[model samples]
Target: MNSNKAVFDSLRNNLKVHYDGKRFSYKSKHDLKDKSQLLVLIRKFPEGIAVIDLKDAYPNVMDDLQALKAVGQIWLLSNFDSQEDIAYPNDPRMVIKVDDDLKQLFPRD
Candidate 1:
């Protein structure tokens, strides 16, 4: 498990400034098949992280699913804000009509 520890350390080191403004910590372990050599689990501190059961954004993420673990977990690091301000389900296609709000942000300039 030393290699796993290294991965965890690397992840934490990289997240030092990415998960700011939160107050939690998460640790996960997973085994991978032939596709991926490693499958690490993600989680948020405490009970703030939401659990996404279905495969939406990343299907490969499910390879490390565990019944006792929480899915769609967020973190409370020092760089990431408690919440994100990005919009979702927005289209960038000008041919397809989009809401005025998204149109302004996703103009075809």
Candidate 2:
């Protein structure tokens, strides 16, 4: 399995977390206040699909992606378009679809 595949598999088997109206209600009782992204996702996904977005360096994204995979949830990382040329500002990271693979989750319509 490639990186994405390995991550997805980890997510599928490891994390048993779900969201419900401003409540994380995870299977584990451990607190995750230190994990900023996790906290954000928990608070923001009160009534929507759970997803984590990453910005900044690629290595950081790789690590967080792995972590999120361990938790068995879907996530997205975005990149900024070239600042020098303003032809297009790349695409924003938004939820398009949910699938077992990355290819199917894009081009959100």
Candidate 3:
């Protein structure tokens, strides 16, 4: 029983260390406050907000948008664009919408 308890403790410590490292790395890469604000703004427009509007409000919107996109937290949609045209963040016609999973995370007041 004592040997089993020792192994469990070792595993727990290892997991804790790994979790903390990931948390720190994530926080360092993204500004939680800014990301939260961006999410809330996007949530306001269920039909999706234009990239130009977001850029106007947040000058450095691309960084946060890209980070969120990389993690599957948001989607970029083209507005009446050709199928071959790639949606770019700088394109005013591009629309941004938050992922359904994240809608609950930033509920409207």
Q: All models: lDDT?
A: 0.33, 0.40, 0.54
Each model's TM-score?
Answer: 0.18, 0.22, 0.41
lDDT measured at residue 12 in model 2 versus the true structure, 0 to 100: 49
Best by TM-score: 3
Between candidates 1 and 3, the one scoring higher on TM-score is 3
Candidate 1 lDDT, tens digit per residue, 24-66? 2432322224212222223212323222322232446444333
Instruction: Supply the global lDDT for candidate 1.
Output: 0.33
Question: Residue 101 CA error for candidate 1 (Å)?
Answer: 67
Q: Which segments of model 1 are wrong by more than 4 Å?
A: 1-41, 67-109
Model 3 RMSD in Å is 18.1
What is the TM-score of candidate 1? 0.18
Return whichever of 1 and 3 wins on lDDT. Answer: 3
Write one digit per residue (lDDT tens) for candidate 2, span 1-109.
2347676555445555534434343343333333445434434543432222222222354455456545545333333442221111112254356566886666666
Better of 2 and 3 by lDDT: 3
| Clash pairs, model 2 backbone | 11-72, 96-108
